[model samples]
Target: MKLFECQNCGQPLYFENTVCESCGHRLGYIPDMNTVSALEPEGDQWRALASSGQLYRFCQNAELDACNWLIPSDHTETHCAACRHNRTIPNLADAENMARYRKLEMAKHHLFYTMIKLKLPLKNRIDDPQGGLAFDFLSDQVDANGNVTTVLTGHDEGLITINVAEADDAEREKRRTQMGEPYRTLLGHFRHEIGHYFWDKIVRDCGEEALEKCRAVFGDEREDYGQALQRHYNTGAPPDWQNNFVSTYATAHPWEDFAETWAHYLHIVDTLETARSFGIKVRPRIKLGHELEAQVDFDPHKANNIDELIENWLPLTYAVNALNRSMGQPDFYPFILSPAVIAKLGYMHELTH
Candidate 1:
């Protein structure tokens, strides 16, 4: 989420920009350097101006307009680091599906950006078939009568399946309303599901001592997950659920709680980085006090601790939400993170550091 400018023209760039608007320079993201640069042709490969002396090629997915990640010319893998984790993709021949698939890739790439910046472990299924990160973007299930069946977006072990329909704004908004959820988006789904994948690696695979600590923070995940989820649906979260959980769904089970908190942690870190990139500062006037002022001059990904993250996050969210309200938009941050929730977030921070 850090600010990027085209190396050739200094045009402010976005994460997924395939071409520089200012100078019409072709762009590619260099994963190892975590940078996006204008490309200059160098025979079969291209030289990235931001990362000089290296020959690079866009991920093969780039041919389909689905990815902009770069792979070294010498690297054996054709897929970039992010696209290599794809276990399944929607039917690309269908124009609609192809569009949705592209949207999904955009979000997935952003997810990988944060993971890489945080230095989190990323082992794709190819690297560890038994337990490694992978994605499955699926179409809606259909019965013999051609009626839509069901396709739930979820994570099982290390594989994350996304119902491709989630990429459609209207469909996603409809579901959000039906589920009584405050927020829903393609990126949110990816962030939340990946939390499950990381839990497997950082907690489950870390041994009994680490697992015990996770349990202490998230509650006993040993509780019957199926039964708990059933109960949560039959009887919605307790009225006071906000006092403990980030979202109503988080109350379903300990695993959900961890994932919800993890998603929020990602949200906070990524947004804060964007704010820093733009040199955003919040200093409310009228003597509201220093608590409402925050200067994001440091890299949020390498924040000293969760407390530091939350300190800056609070003021930034406050300002952004107010700006959103000014524009007649919904609050940028609708859910409240209580003291208990903050403690859980701290544990999630500990998982990374």
Candidate 2:
């Protein structure tokens, strides 16, 4: 993430900031422009400082104490662009549910930011006959009682389900340790699940030719998903899994391989954007159009194209990881992208262009 500032006072601001501390200006995120603008009340509602004619208000869910985004009241959609598609939220009667849901919402916003930056189309599941894109911030076994026995995170069709427990640092850390995953976070979960959503949107929707190519590159996705999942749980990943798959689970199915690669694509792009913000640069050796295209201008707030993105990222990640070692902290980036992974990333890059 890049730094933000108050439009009124030029004071430092954060993505989630509702009020600028230095200038005391009310702030709202404009999704259309991918900007957070300082605002002033116009009569009873809020208007952007740069465009006062556009009427806006904090999300009604915010009034109910659930969201922090702004929305146009005159618009037919009651929820903000981000919140409008929420299919299921945990019961807010329990205080913990609200906090967890808020955290999930924040992560979702970041996910949407990257998706929009890539010019990826986002349609809510409700808007699609097969349920295109939906969210389920759920109460899992870890968060809920009364005979509930459900896993915290999973994606099916277009619905991404997240266990509220994942929002709790301690609980998430414990799961991370148990799962032996090098990296995990709320944002990671969102990116990964959205990967699944996009695979369905892109690969599954594309015609037979694309499906054949995907199967040849990844694997056959026709395997029974439930059986493959059961087998993965029972027997664990294959011994030589690392040679072909981005993750152990990626070996379960071709669809998973696509999702894992998609998530990594987001990770690479976002991290590269952050790196460029800090003035990190890499010496370009080979000149591929796609590689050069990955270079992005470092905007501390808005998103940019994926080209020029990973160029700066490769170096910035190395420097940060070394810096972390100097401080006795774990490496900031712990995963290695093999040549095969790079090929998969290339496929994703093609999708973006």
Candidate 3:
């Protein structure tokens, strides 16, 4: 995510800010321009200072304080580009559910920001009912007898289901510990699941040629997915799994491998952009011949290759990890990037390009 400035006061701003801290101006994100604007009331509509002469309104979800995105006043759709893809939302009347849904929306909006910056294709279910992006934020169901049926978070075709409980910090941390995962978050979930959705569009539906290329990188996805997952859970990842897969769970199947790598790719580029926005640089004293020095002066989204991203990412991660250690926190990034992982990330770069 890029750093933003309040048009009214020129103060530094964040993507999710609904009001300017300095100038006390209302703020709304205009997706078409990829910037947040200070709004001026004009009858029932708002005039965006960042995009002059245009009238806009906040998404209908704004009524619930769940969205800050804006739609052009002339557009027919009331929902913003991001919220329009939501097929199902939790019961907002329940205060707990409403709070969880808010957290989910925050992460979902961050995911959409990266996708829009990358110029990825986005079609809501309304646009293509058979195969279009959609979200279902669901809670576990309970029977009259008090038997609970858990909702597993995963992607099916273009629909992504998120167990709303994942939005709770304690619940998510408990699951992360139980699963033995080094990293897990709502944004990571969104990125990983959307990776599967893109695979459908960029590989499976492309043709035999595209499928062959993807298979060469991610292995044969034709293998029985259920059996692969069952075996993974039964025996766990191989001893040397780190040499090949991005995460232990990635070893479950080829589809998972692709999604894990894809999520990491998104993590790298987006975090690097944030570093660049703040003009962050890492140049450690007594460095080993520029091995731990990086100047993020270019956009990662338009990086020439995966190697370019990795080169900067390593130094940044090292500095961040050290800072986290100083604060008695866990390592900011606990995963390793082996040579094999780099190669897979290269394939992801190619696919996105």
Candidate 4:
């Protein structure tokens, strides 16, 4: 999520930019280099100007406009690092499906960007067919009896399934309101689900010591997940849930608590990195001493401790929330961070490192 610019023209660029607007040069992301670079067409291949003249080809999914990542031309693999993990994509023949799939890819690619930045383990189905990470984008099915079965977004083993409908802003907003969620987005969904994937890989499989530490912070994930969710829906979160949990839904189960907290951990670090990229420093005119002042001058991903991140995050949230209100919009971040929640986030920080 760091800022990128067109190497050819020095024009500002974005994560999804496929072509530099100012210089008219084609663009492709070099995953290993972790940068979006200007490209020069070289017969059937491309020369990455920012990658020491390395020759490459677009990921196979690029033909569908579903990916703009690159692959070395000499490499046998056709897909880029991120798209290679997709086990299933919606039927591209359907125009709506194609559009929705594109939206999903944009979010998924952003998730991978952070994953790569964090050096998290990534094993596509090809790498570990039995338990490697993968994705499935599915559509709702309607029966002849006029019954519609909605596809639920979730993760099982190493496969993450997402309902294509979530890509539609209207449907997503409706679900957010119905579920009483203050914030929800395609990127949030990816981060939350991937949290489950990592819990399996890093916590569950690591060892007894790791499991014990996780249990101490996130509670015993061995609790009955199905029963916990059923009870949660029936009675709802406890009145003082915010004192111990990040969200009402997080109160459903220990596993959920971890996932919800993990997602927020990603939210804080990534947004802080973005703030640093812009050299954002908040110093309100009516400052209450240094409590409200912050300067994102360090790499959030490599922060020495969770407390450091929280200190920097609070000021940014306060500043942005005010800016959002100025435009008559809801707060950019609408949740509070309690000491207990910060502890869980600390666990996530430790685990990622």
Error of 4 at 92 (Å): 1.5
lDDT of each: 0.92, 0.75, 0.95, 0.94
How far out, in Å, is residue 216 in model 3?
A: 0.8
TM-score of 4: 0.98
Residue runs of model 4 more than 4 Å from their true location after superposition: 287-289
Q: Over the stretch 1-353, how does candidate 2's per-residue lDDT look in tens digits? A: 55566778888776788888888898888777667779988888888874557888887677655565777757776788778678888898888887888788888888887887777878886577575688878775543556767765888888888888999989999988887777888998888888888777777788888788777778789989889878887888899777767777677777778888888888887776665555554443556534423333555223343334444555666666878999998888777766676677777777654
Stretches of candidate 2 off by over 4 Å are 64-66, 141-148, 238-240, 281-309
**RMSD for each of the candidates:** 1.0, 4.4, 0.8, 0.9
**Candidate 2 residue pairs in clash (backbone atoms < 3 Å):** 125-133, 293-307, 293-308, 294-307, 294-308, 294-309, 295-307, 295-308, 295-309, 296-308
Q: TM-score of each candidate?
A: 0.98, 0.87, 0.99, 0.98
Considering lDDT, which of the candidate structures 1 and 2 is the better prediction for this target?
Answer: 1
Q: Write the per-residue lDDT of candidate 4 for residues 1-353, one digit (tens) a residue.
A: 78899998899999899999999999999999989999999999999989885799999999999899999998999899999999888888999999999999999999999999999999999989988999999999999999999899999999999999999999999999999999999999999999999999999899999999998887898888999999999999999999999999999998898899999999998999999989999998884847889999999989999999999999999999999999999999999999999999998998999
Worst 10 residues of 1 by lDDT: 282-291
Each candidate's clash count: 0, 10, 0, 0
What pairs collide in candidate 3?
Answer: none
Encode model 3's per-residue lDDT on 1-353: one tens digit a residue: 89999988899999999999899999999998999889999999999999969899999999898899999999999899999999999999999999999999999999999999899989999999999999999999999999999999999989999999999999999999999998889999999999999999989999999999999988999999999999999999999999988899888999999999999999999999999999998999874847788999999999999999999999999999999999999899999999999999999998899
Off by over 4 Å in 3: 287-289
Q: Which candidate, 1 or 2, would have the higher TM-score against the true structure?
A: 1
The list of candidate 1 runs beyond 4 A from truth reads: none
Error of 4 at 224 (Å): 1.0
Error of 1 at 318 (Å): 1.0
Error of 4 at 17 (Å): 0.5
